[model samples]
Target chain A: MNTSKPAAGKAPAGGGRETARRARTRERLLDAAYRQFCEHGINGTSIEAITDDAGFTRGAFYSNFASKEELFLALTERENRARLETLRDRFDEVVAPLGRVAGKPDPELIEGAIADILAVQPDNRQWCLLNSEFKLLAMREPQVAPRFLESVRTFQQELAAMVDTALASVGLRFSVDSGHLTRLLLDHFESAMQEAILAGAEDAERAVRDNVMRTLPSLVHSLTEVRPPGS
Target chain B: MNTSKPAAGKAPAGGGRETARRARTRERLLDAAYRQFCEHGINGTSIEAITDDAGFTRGAFYSNFASKEELFLALTERENRARLETLRDRFDEVVAPLGRVAGKPDPELIEGAIADILAVQPDNRQWCLLNSEFKLLAMREPQVAPRFLESVRTFQQELAAMVDTALASVGLRFSVDSGHLTRLLLDHFESAMQEAILAGAEDAERAVRDNVMRTLPSLVHSLTEVRPPGS
Candidate 1:
């Protein structure tokens, strides 16, 4: 174990390495907390439980996160960032190739992009539970609401930007504001996952995929129009 | 207060009156529990807190509900029934007149019906929080899942039936399964409410009304078509 000195004075030689190690530690703690929070709710789980599950001490947890709520927020940010990155990568791989060869946007290509993006997350049930828990907490706790809203808006804006770029690549743009479009799509996707989980569908993930695929592609098509020729 | 005898050995003259009184007690308890749960979550609250809030003794609570979870489920049923009743009443007041008129479903009537239904709930933030909390609990607890699922399906089916009747009365019907269409509209409505609450909009209720109104009428029109002459 690399027991590096604290950065109280001049920068250490291995500062970059130390920062990477701290990030890994934080990630591990978050993973453990996520599992515990899903199994037993946020209020039911304790900091000690998370630290023990992560194989760390209380000191390590405090150094990383000030409180359980903060850890929850950090987890939210991490999960949202990870999802956005996955979407960006998937969109690039599946839809970017068609960008160069531009005519009217192919329905098949748009459908494929929607399917691929929806398919990126397979563990819909766990995610739905965690996300719902966080949302409820934010709603009830006024102090947490602003920060939670910020994180949500950040994710929405980033996703909206990606959607705009992908659409522009194919000579199309949303008839409504891209941000509004993003919110609508996300609302549908989240609702689909929750419904699938509640219904105890044989394959919750596939249920979400099928439900979304049935309506979202057509909705997207209707919401998009050919870009104007001139700016 | 009627300290009525138990309905054990023989039927009493006041049996019906006693049953009505018991139902009133249950409703009172549920109303109190809903407020407490909204204020300090399901898990954060205790049985004592609920009974105290309802001005009932522990015995009264136990007589009415077996456990907190059971009370929570009862609250869910009561709220769902209340909302359905309100929607039914609102639809009757606003759209039933048009039901007798025989022409293509007026866009204005459809919009008005949608608006009235959405406007029926003024406390979106509280409902969103409580609903999300219960959903998370249901997702985490397997025993609660089946009952919760039943309540959800019951609501969806009843709402679908209403939608079918209303649309048919206006010489139209859902192109898709009425249940599926109901789910889509509900998903959008719930999402819009959550978003408005999270954004801390000046009027979260109005925001939900506006957001749902903007898209749902168009979506509904697209989803419905003229009914077959005989069928």
Candidate 2:
């Protein structure tokens, strides 16, 4: 049950070793589940399939997670956390890059920050497919929807906060509300990425890169140039 | 096999009546299937369920379409046609409104045309859900994906043509390619509408109205104001 990492080399009795082993098993299961879910949809993928793919038995899956849904939710959380961490690290580096003046960030630099934050990878197509399946299922099942939506909202809020911090670091903010801008940008980005994947476009990552590089700088320019109404 | 509309009063003897009746049955089934698929996903709903909802027998469905996939593709074509017709009508109205003076269309009028074309409806949420499901399935199934992507590309090309006509009527064009603008605008609109539905936001139509009214005009302005490089 306790999956938290033990304090750096501070092994207490044999608990640390046991926790480490359990953590490895859980991570392995989650990784395999991600691939399987992407290949075969949620319903198409079974608990036994996930366990067998992970090289673990059904009992091992049950020991670490209650069910497929449980494992999927864990994957969702892990993916979101990993993405946020990547964005934050990239954002931090750009907003305070060496030789940068402490004023409103250059529109190009902000665009570069966004591009860095949103750079696509080979694995992202699978993630996008799996995410859409999860979203459709959540929409159909009312019982699970509230939790799924709550997670989405939480993730959006965290993303907006990071955007705000990144902007503030350069003494600038969106003329529109940062939260609204974040939602708009994220929506636009997700849809574009999804389309590129669905069309099986050659150089999908470059498609995203070329798109954001062209669009975001101009969008940020507009947001920065225009003042809020009555301001 | 012949789903085309019959010429007015130009029927081929007794064949015309049967053809008309068959067309009506097919249309009714497609409409019913749209509702059923929205409520219960593509996989979740059964053929029996669709037939029962349509007040037709399984024979009716089989005779009209080979399977659910066939029915769904037909629905997709129908939906695309309907939407394009609506946009064409509205675009015509704005592009050539009755007036004594004839010149470049006003920016505001073009904006109005765009807004009228994008007006949302109560049923759109359902359609979006069903469409997303279809898209995800198409992505997972290689056999279906090529056809689906081709359909998408055709629809997008048609939309781009409409956008081009609308802009030309106004003596304006996007600094970017019309096709790229069409894709960008569609992606933005669909995602915004999806978010509003997923969040169960009150006044979903109004939310779409407000968001598009605010964002699109500015986006179009940016695209129009700047000249394409070397243009």
Candidate 3:
């Protein structure tokens, strides 16, 4: 609850100092849980293991989060939020140079934007592993599936909005639904990254980057068209 | 061991009757493991659970496979081989009527072929879950990664060949690497299925079918071209 700003100086309600301290505790627990979940997986990891890794007591974990699943949901939200923020920043950076360009953006510009957005994820391998684990867990647990879908939809919408704004800045828009296009790009990027990691390639990062760079530009070129004037 | 032809009357190498019985046992164990792995997970399901589910002793399980990881590898091979066979049959069905087309096949023909190929898998949900679980396990386990990648590559190559043959039959070929194109199609198809399952949609199967139908044809169209006559 309200763990987004762990380092915030001021907090609302429930006593300022206590709330900030609690947020810090939750944040630390989430950090440790992310590492543990990525390394050992969700079901394979236990509450005690996460708490111990976080340097907290079981009581602390229970107080901060009711269950490992609850903690996982929180972590999912945090990671998605952070990723969206990075994408938003990267989108802005990619668009800031082109302020209302005439006609459609050049293929190079679109390709550069795609590359920048893709490169925003720093820990691709760990995130890919953790995301796949969470997905499988959600698929098995019916109770968690809807919540997982909600989080995914939220992230997709936010990223889609950023993509729309970025493309609109360059007088280009997707021929298909923006959300669908975003999902396709995200799926392909993750799949490529997963493949590279599974292959245990020495230059997995570069290989994924190159693969996406090679494949996605043409895809983007085909899926997008110039935004018609006078909507 | 040679578990592919479990029902084969004649066996190579060892005693025919004994080898046949062993292959049958291994096949049963794999079937049970597949169900168990999809229901629970690779890490969560014990070998005893698998053996018990197969109505066999733990000794039988060990005799057939060295470890759960080994069993998983074997299961992966079995599944991929089965899937490729299905795709091959489906491809042949889609192509047999054409009778060696002169120019590029029509868009509808291409789309129908894709739909048939995509529909070849009977249990999309189970395979999606099991495949994701295995991929995550491979990521965490170093020894299994290479073997996993090998299975994936073999599958990809075989599927690519089917794709190439199908396209060539219709006087069309991929502008991109056929293997990469096959990987992309498989990745998207699996991603769509996984999303539908995760969303708990009542018409999950239909939704995945429709999503791929809408998105992939254009992708395939853009990625393919008429095959050069002389080449």
Candidate 4:
């Protein structure tokens, strides 16, 4: 209710320049708001805090985002999308060995994906700060919680699909419970991420990740056990 | 801090009766406090709300709990301990049938454990509520953050010890990263609990758990991979 309404401005030369400037201001506010929210939590954060961090006026904040809630929706969407792209790219970057290149996934590729998330994602302190604090912001504002969960679902589904495809191609699958394996893997990644976030390198997230790759061979073996007649 | 300090009073004639009554009062307050905290969060609920729920007065709240922070810490410890006991007892109850006696775990034992947690623990809304909101409280006052992390660590270590003993008895030992595996398994249980608590069985939580006993065989097989003799 006490939020700005979107405007449909005329498409004039000055209007175009104003649109571009507005986009920049929005991006700045988003970045600053993200950091603040991650640290201080969403409710704990204020419009003034966001504007101050971004070095903009409160007018500019309202001009860019309708409300604090809308900004968070944007942040959740943006973060998930960006992280997904990064994960896929990490997978695509590995240069598999000549022999293994024909079929098996390069360990480097998978390991890199795990390592990259461990290295670059906000530290556990920030994540705990976010999880403990800011997640409430998403749930309190009805427009955000389901959408946020949907985004997570989309990611999980896509990742599951990718793993499913990989296993199928390799003649490895599980009829007993392929779905369970995929969910467990997703859960594994999330748990590892959380531990990595909280304990930092003391958990040696990267090292455990290396072990994760070794587990994959056993995974492939299990798949062989449960795969369809010809899969 | 006006909380009953464990031995706050003693009735001369019938100390046993007074002690029993006081113990019951403490338990009632804890139960009410937990329900309130789960719904509202540590910061969201107050002494007033707790007392109202527990059928006590403001003065009674003071008599039982020294401070809001102290109550919160106590509630957290109580719930976590209870959860561990629940998980452990469930595992113990199922071990003979699932692992040793059955030659391997059947779906029943594992499914039973998962189901018990879902049924016995707090509802989805409450758990998800904590998942969403507790992080903020943890961040604002990190003095207890270590304790939270320690709780998780202790759980994982205890689980690892149980796993180690189980595998040893079976003449199958964890050669892979047992620590990570323990963390991973515990994480799955917790994640499933949260999912059950949150959106309510939206993902593969049930399906995955249904075959937890079955899938675990293949998993344990994989974990037996030999680590090189000595690097």
DockQ of each: 0.38, 0.33, 0.50, 0.26
lDDT string for model 3 (A135-193, tens) is 88888888888888789889988989988887777677887778876787778788888
TM-score: the better of candidates 1 and 4: 1
Clashing pairs in 3: none
Instruction: Answer with 1 or 2, whichever has the higher lDDT.
Output: 1
Q: In candidate 1, what fraction of native interface contacts survive?
A: 0.46
| lDDT for each residue of candidate 2 in B1-231, tens digit (9 for 90 to 100) | 988977877887668788789999999999989888887788988999999999999999999999888888888888888877777767756655412235434557557756766662335677778888988888777667777777777888998998777656545566666776677677767766666666666766666777777767655654564223354
Candidate 2 has an lDDT of: 0.73
Q: Arrange candidates by TM-score, descending.
A: 3, 1, 2, 4
Model 3 clash count equals 0
List model 1 lDDT by residue over A1-231, tens digit each.
Answer: 979865575767668767888999999999999999987888889999999999999999999999898999999998899888888877767666446556556667678878877777757678788888888778767778788989988999999999888777766777666776677678778887887887778898999899888877766665567788763
Interface RMSDs of the predictions, in order, are 2.7, 3.0, 2.0, 4.3
**Residue B70, model 2, lDDT:** 84
Q: Write the per-residue lDDT of candidate 3 for residues B1-231, one digit (tens) a residue.
A: 766654675655677778778999999999999989877778779998999899999999989899999999999999999888877777877775443555655667668777776676677777888888888889778899989989988998888888788777767787767776677777778888888988887777777999888887766766668778776
The residue ranges of model 4 lying beyond 4 angstroms of the native Cα positions read A1-19, A55-64, A95-128, A139-143, A161-186, A189-231, B1-22, B52-66, B87-93, B99-125, B159-179, B193-231
Q: Give stretches of model 1 more than 4 Å off.
A: A1-14, A96-112, A174-177, A221-231, B1-14, B96-113, B173-178, B214-231
Candidate 2 has which clashing residue pairs, if any?
none
How accurately is candidate 2 docked according to DockQ?
A: 0.33
CAPRI quality of model 2: acceptable
- lDDT (C-alpha) at residue B216 in model 3: 77
In order of listing, the candidates' clash counts read 0, 0, 0, 8
